[model samples]
Target: MGTRQTAIRRGTNLPRMGDFNESVVLDAIRRVPGGLSRVELAESTGLSAQTVSNICRRLLDHGLALETGKKSFGSGKPRTLLRVNAEARFAVGVHLDPAVITYVVLDLLGNVVAHLRVPTPPVADPEQTLSGLSESIRQLIEESGVPADRLLGLGIAAPGPVDVAAGLVVDPPELEGWGRVPLRDYLAEETGLPVVMDKDVIAAAIAERWAGAAAHSGNFLFFYLGTGSGMGLVVEDTVLRGVSGNAGEVGGLGAACTTRGMVDEAIHLGVLSHDFTPIGPRDAERSLAELCRLAAEGNATAGDIIDRQAVRVGRGVCAAATLVDAELIVFGGPIWPHVADRFLRIVPALVEKSPFVKSLHPTRVTSTEVGDDVGAVGAACLVLDRTLSAQPQSLLLA
Candidate 1:
């Protein structure tokens, strides 16, 4: 099929009597800085006052939150205060790519306590790869000397399109026969921890929106230019997972010869080979990396190849901006920083000169400081945003 699409099937539910009670209460308190009274929480959440009181007590007891101060606005007297501890629990985030896997241990406040990187498996074998990942997680936890129980769980930023709900790598073209691999289940079973999965670009966008530059922009496009290219859209702090959960597969937007008037320039230039692997998720990383190095080395032939790639990328961005109406575009893939200083200088001009830019200025394009770790860090942020937000299970743990 020309388009990569799949049905997102749900997994069996894990029991959770207290999966997110304290977190919900704490997030509410943090929203209303001065601290919300039990009555206010009840009014806001529609939970009974007694339920709110019980949750607040648990939060206070666990040291995840406290009644810093009290407020008086009624005749009967003021209720005790409640606010997020901001230093309560911690989570481990690991982003796995073909080249490297980045590990970040973040605190409740989203501060990075430690960050590390290790090489990924050279070959694609699920059993071997997952065993190494389990070892990595254990080693990082042991080396940091943090109690395993203190960690909420692990969030993995997986490369390529994934079935987030079921935690499977569905039809990953880059990996040999990786289709329908139950990654989440394998990792969770091996590590004895709950694992959450997200597409790398989507995870990167989550990290950017939660803590990076795009945090302020509600409607933004995250252009993840890693070994390959992908995009993610965040509309009002929420990711837009289109019909088949493959909304941001920009590489598959179809490579037309935008450099020339016709599409055959790519064919004539020999940059793309039909006999080779199809330009699906399977061969993007290897192909793009070779092209980036050639372009960087000032090889005229390679430069021409990359120029065509850039034009195609810019056109894809234009199409994405038009379709999603994203206000800001942030670049955060591996290739960006290598040539960002030079790339940015020419991108806006090319975009503006395009036919689509006549009315609306193409979305603002900028580099992300998050860099290579964007996906892994974003994986961790997904956990935090899930366990610490008003609706705890709505995003991460779900």
Candidate 2:
């Protein structure tokens, strides 16, 4: 018989809740900023007082919830309130870019504890590169002074055309010697910790949902302009991972809009830069930093390159917005730090200029407030999202 085919999946983790009621209680308490009293929690979750007390006790014991000052609504006795202990646990997130490797340590409340950026080693030597990154991960854990045991796990966001089922990077165009490299398993084995892996843009989308620009956005598109360009689609509150794990690969769309007879492929960084603004020329400090400087200094050539790039990107966004009916478009990535203001100002109007898109209300386009840390932060949010965020599946199982 042939090997079974399980490549088709949404890339979501179904972590069986050890105690559904406890999770529900925790979710309810976390949603409130000032915390909620046991009575309020019980009323909101529809759990009995005794059950709420029991669950609260467990939550407090685990350091997942903290008891704050008492609150009294009426003439009744003051009741102790509970809140999520934002510092109780930590998670590590890594974003592997061809230009740089980004790392972030996040607390329970989605706050950054520690962050670092390091030069990326060529994937041509996968093992050595993995080992080096493993060392960086260890250093962050020790330096942050967070107990190793309290760490939830490591989450990684790598560039795409990846084989999500095998947790491998399969011939991702921008990177070299990364064919069928089992990144998830290798990192897990190297660090002796649980690891979760997803495409870089997908992870960014999850980060947006957690606490970034798209926090309350039910439907949106994250246009990632990194060493290359891609898009992340979140429709109806779920990140859409297509059959092969590469859903929003829209690099070709930019080239398609122009008439240069050029082939715009998915892996090439053509969509992200122009001849005047070459991204990472193997010698420059950064891909677009110098170009941005020139443009800021009134260089018409550099300014023109950025302008055309933005127009094409806006056209692509407008097309995607029309197709997905996206309410918002978040422009982000490592490169956005230098050109975010320009993208935000230019892209929205360009998108609105489209007759099709003009009919629909103008789509909101903005830079990632999280800035350069988005990819790594997004990576970390994946673990927190998978492990702690309340899911509708829990309701069904309960």
Candidate 3:
């Protein structure tokens, strides 16, 4: 028998090289809202003048960048300025919470073109839930009227314990009956687009970095309060996803601050009647909302329940902020809107009083600027970040 020899082809670096350079140039233009000149792009990205010109030409031709106007600097020739064409590309984001699933279509500039919120089906069957989610996404995109070709991809912000590598949603505490569902791959196949997944808190943090409260701050902590609770840590402008892609799990802090925990506590303390006992994620939210109403109406017991939770949250965030040396702490999630007024009043003081936080640098405490739908917005940002944003990790070989 004759043995056939197989030739192994060596991989070339040219394929990713142009993409990386283009991303760098695009990122530079995006940073300057008013726009940047080709000279400025060359200077900022450390690319050659010809390379910048070539990239800018490609960007303009692709409708990703536009020549906004012209500017002259110190007797130099008038330089044409280029800015990102926000409408040129779009991304879909789905935030899968236990109580509700939020869907949003965002333009390249991170502006929401359209959005919808639907109560999550109460069924424990993952297939049924997945079908509903897929349909909702399709409806949203169709109703929004965005060109399918312009859509970069879909992103999902799910609860913690997500296996990001495998694109699976592990057994999240709040999302029952979803055991190791291949969310990313399923969505990618269903939507005919690339899909990315991250923890909801992490996604929220990325959202803030992209367009919300942390837009100006490189180091910050996003304290997310929803059906459950957790923190998203960004240090030195890099989001920290540990070895397992679950870096922000608060463990006990999350248990102590969950909406369900608060509702249960209210019931046990007689602040809320047994009839108010939560039967599901939405029930917990409703009960918590009622508790907030009672507290606002001068019910001391209800107020105390919320206040104590504030204290616990405050302590947890302060420790995290100090640990990561974050300069800003943003709080938001579905449940945050219900408790923002209360949390702001208490958490800020605790942060200001922390010796480490106060003595080193002022840690600004604020709510999310991305609104209550930050998770959804962040989900979209995952696509934007992956496709557009220039990161050092992209240079590493697979």
Show model 1 residue runs off by greater than 4 Å.
Answer: 1-62, 65-86, 255-304, 350-363, 392-398
- Residue ranges of candidate 3 with Cα displaced over 4 Å: 1-17, 46-50, 72-78
Ten-residue segment with the worst summed lDDT in candidate 3?
1-10
Candidate achieving the largest lDDT: 3
Residue 181 displacement in candidate 1 (angstroms): 1.7
Q: TM-score for every candidate vs. truth?
A: 0.70, 0.81, 0.91
| Per-residue lDDT of model 3, residues 1-398, tens digit only | 01111111111134556777888788667766888888877666667788889888999999999999899888979989999999999999999999999999999888999999999888877898899889999999999999999999999999989999999999988777888999999888888889999999999999998878877677899999998888999886679999999988877675657898899899999999999998899999999999999999999999999999999999999899989988899999999999999999999999999875757678999999999999999999999988987665667867
Candidate 2 residue-wise lDDT, 116-171, digit = tens: 88888754767777888899998888888888888999999998878878889878
Which one wins by TM-score: 1 or 3?
3
Per-model clash counts, in order, read 3, 0, 0
Question: Candidates' lDDT values, in order?
Answer: 0.67, 0.75, 0.87
The regions of model 2 sitting more than 4 angstroms off are: 1-32, 37-57, 70-81, 255-287, 351-363, 393-398
Ranking according to lDDT, highest score first: 3, 2, 1
Winning candidate number (TM-score)? 3
Model 1 agreement with the true structure over 1-398: per-residue lDDT tens digits: 01101111111122353444555455456545466778777665556667677777887888888777777875878777776665577778888776667888777656677788886665656667778888888888777766777888888888777777778887665555566888888888988877888888888887886667675566788888665568889775568777655667765655442112111343356654544333333244444455556567775765665565566677777777666677677877655665465467666666666666435544677788566688888888878877665442443653
lDDT of 3: 0.87
